[model samples]
Target: MKHGRALTITITLLITVLFAVSAGCTGPVQQPSASPAVTAPAADGSSLVFTDQEFAFELRRTIGASYAGEADIGECLATASRIQEGDFESWYTEWNRTADAFRAAGDGSLAAGHRVSAMEAYYRAATYYRTAEFFLHGNPADPRIVETWSKSRDAFRDAIALDVVPYEIVAIPYENTTLPGYFYTVDDSGISRPLLIVQTGFDGCQEELHPYAMEGIRRGYNVLTFEGPGQGEVIRVQHIPFRADWENVIAPVVDYAAGRPDVDEDRIALWGISLGGYLAPRGAAYEPRITALVADGGTYDVGQNLLQNLQEGGGAPANLTEDDLQEWLQTDPAEFNDAILGAMAHDTGTRWLNENGMFVFSAASPAEFWAKWMEFSLAGIAEEIRCPTLVCAGAADHFDPDGVQAQALYDHLTCERDLMVFSDDYGAGSHCQLGAFAQSFAAKFDWLDDRMGMSG
Candidate 1:
């Protein structure tokens, strides 16, 4: 399969992503209001479709990359057609098969001396492999997690090698070891340019940020994307869990970028996606060297929101605070955990969020996970930020449906700030605008360009 392979797609269903649910919360897992009920269509339909909202959203995520060759429209539709909604095994099997097919296609294209075709095929393979591994984190011990992730990384590396622009897989020195990153430059002209540093939030890899980096590179910026503790290779290979003090992570990354001759140290910008919406802002609060910060859908207080969700849903009492939550857990952790576990049993998104949180946060159980989650707040720190910041939100954000988190973060800012909320009318209202890359990139880079005085 190749790019632009007879593709016509649309977000026919309204799907919403979920935030973690607190133990006391009681409600059906929140999702977007569905359109009129209809059977999921065949692959050759006007668009690849899914009746399951999560399935539909994720499938559209891959298909959206068709413009850049990270995904092929025909292949995504064909693979998605065979997978059963909410069936992890089926999802994994179909995507894995497609990945292997693309990988083989790339190898054959390379042998035929078709570098462009090889690059496109490898890109598709990498994305498919990543998609295959998406739901496996629920079982932390699953061997397929590492194997599929490795294939994705390897395929991405191979694809980047064939790019016309310069790309480097870098290992930046951290505490005791090195953090993996990919650096892309507009050119090797030995001229320093503004740099954009990016990291994905929980459950995303550095390789998946390739299209984001390409956006910067095309707009006369050098891009450096890395995975910190609890993310990408750091968590998978080094066994490092996430730390709330993100400045410790961002500072070292800044040091590395500042030392590079090709990076303009004065114009370094940081972007955090999804959960990173919280992480990047926390980093900027303490790291004064950062020139600008972008939180793609701001997250103010994760634990608070989770608990508040419970409160609103009648799971917990009114005005529940962190201290109250901790006291409840300490009083009878087993009982508290049972409530959370029961809730997780009903919601796939909630289960994955907590399970993945436990693994990445190094919490022993649900109670412990929520305890640690409380520390990821920007309560007193937001006002400390010195750099201009951009806080984005989806009008119908699955994780922040009310848009309160982004508004809170914006309100707390004492520095120069702007809030951009994407509306669903443009198909850019999903989490981080997953299915609308062009709109998301344009809004983000345009803001950064103006902030850095690089706007044309």
Candidate 2:
């Protein structure tokens, strides 16, 4: 089966290359939006605190629900009020301060014998710590970045130790090392139970997966949330660079889960969020043991996005063929680096992308990083997915707006497939349905339950 899938992918790639050269055309790139100011409020009553709307939405979604409402909100508002637009230092300082306060509160609570309060406070502190480290990618070796992340991990460990359900911190052996993860189980029934493997996207960590894992737990499923290469402690501590071949990562993880006595190997499912949309499907294509797959905001060709951004920035030609594009990417790196730096100087989004991309991809220059990102795609491999698959996207997801990638992947899938587009009418039309987690989870777990033979 693997050999057949490989052959299919090779043929598909050949045909795609032929089509690309014959067509001699590429889609026009949309113009880049103006650098908007991160102000307190707009006339519409929306807070313009974060330069990125998606970031703002995600922050709001997690704060009250995942963190302490009063302290986190107050800290957030105060920070936003003073944050200089696109200033990573300012952002880190405020969030880090808030995290410190939360950690102190958790310690006090625990000392007072308020276990539940301590657990909640510790969880909130961990999230705050993660938030602080989000934009500090300019220097991967920065001591503060490592310190903050360590604090986050410690807080999460403390929280889970006091959790109602059993939460086990695990170290799944990979190629030369191990990946960190948390296993959430309702009980030690000794009977095998359905399992869900949760993979976070570009900026997400294992700690942030608690909400999603809890949802799966309530549905009687054991959940494992792990951070692979280029994510969380794996990237920070072990310095494992990101790779496009996610099958290598998932296969090892699946091996670990299959060996566990509590996991029902036949009912194992994989769920990927944000950028994991692309990673999960790519893994499912090669790792055929997975029974079901869910991509929360699907992606088909990651290169298309990079090309679009490049074209919008007037760095690439609209009609550039694949061969021509590849040659162009190999050109003088210094010039490309300068262009990226200039763009980052004015655009907050561009700045974040440049810094984060270089760190995760371990590329010396922006051009190389972009070139590497182009490798992560499901164009030819989507058809190899044999398991029941669910592709989800928000109607207004700026990351994959119009659900183009999800739609494309769904159309190409050879197995039983489902695509659910959360709409703005229900306040779910944001990236990852951030403001509508319940609706998104309902759609995901419902589809998963039916496919996994679980009755609600």
Candidate 3:
């Protein structure tokens, strides 16, 4: 639904990429596994692998959330049994069915004063509702998108209302409006503590970031998570597209947090996931208030990454430099749109990527999307960051299979930095370590603890 990464088109197989948010996983790190070799072509002109890789990956993401109580193993399996393999409508139908059941159960529990049960049901309902809305971006005018997203946000808020720790729905001031957010504090003692600012990437919203906020709270750190322009409420309600200069966003967030009595201005950390990997570092480069930074699945030069993926998949000519690609996009807009849109008709992942990209970035055409993507590069910005940064990379990341983006960011950083390459042996090799939230969060927060001297 939410592809956080570039589309990779293989002969007869398209690898789906989600460059946003964590799902779940549990384990220790180990060496990387050997690449999956493509079997010999059969008489039918297809590889022996007969699977809808995109659907399978999304299913894994759903089931993986069970580890955090965001889903139930049996419930997810039962839902999958009814979903038609690659049919987006079927996927939405089944997930929404389950969400309705869960929401009803939560209502019953709350009516009986069973707060704990109500909390769990509400959380799971939120996740299912979010999943149901994933594939609806293709039609921007779909009413189901807003209805489902609102349900997810409302469910999450209801669940958190029953939590032991303090949680507040906040409105962080921006230029002409306020950004929606959730603020979590370790306690109500009014003591100043380090704050971890968690922001969403391409597809996920602030609600899905609840687990990360809880993790921060457990580690004696306050957490603030919000949806920036082009994400969550900002895009859905305000219709503001994403901006290349992210410092403006982070600076206002920091101002809001610093004004709070519980937040330590000098010990704040900025952690971004998926596309946030690029956005966070981009902001840290200019925002001097961030004491530490984490870019999960670090990205540098997203435009180049997209172009390279297209080139490798035969969607673009080989060795097309940035200048060449720009010239072609401007000179032959019709040809560019035809090539991309034609490919989208047959591939689910590509279609979602293009459609979602256009929706969030507010691009009217594919060529314009590519041009806007070029503005997000961190070529000369990485060196400007002064905070101690942790750049994370999955050994088998679909979008950055070779860890090129992470390496580029890590290599360019002049500040104290660490590059963490998570191996696939631990089930943490996917983009943003979607199925390995536990291992990913443990490693990420551990680094932040050491940097901030919060280690126990």
lDDT by residue (102-157, candidate 1, tens digit) is: 99999999999999999999999999999998877767788998899999999998
Please write out the lDDT profile of model 3 over residues 238-335, one tens digit for every residue.
98999989999999999999999999888999999888888999999999999999898688886666566566777555656766655555443665
Model 3: lDDT to the true structure: 0.77
Candidates ranked by lDDT, best first? 3, 1, 2
CA lDDT of each prediction against the hidden true structure? 0.76, 0.71, 0.77
- The predictions' CA RMSDs to the true structure, in order, are 10.0, 9.1, 6.1
TM-score pick, better of 2 and 3: 3
Model 3 pairs whose backbones collide:
4-18, 4-19, 24-435
Candidate 1 vs candidate 2, lDDT winner: 1
Q: Estimate each model's TM-score.
A: 0.88, 0.85, 0.88
Off by over 4 Å in 3: 1-50, 309-320, 330-332
Clashes by residue pair, model 1: 24-315
lDDT for 340 (candidate 2): 61
- Show model 2 residue runs off by greater than 4 Å: 1-48, 51-58, 64-75, 308-319
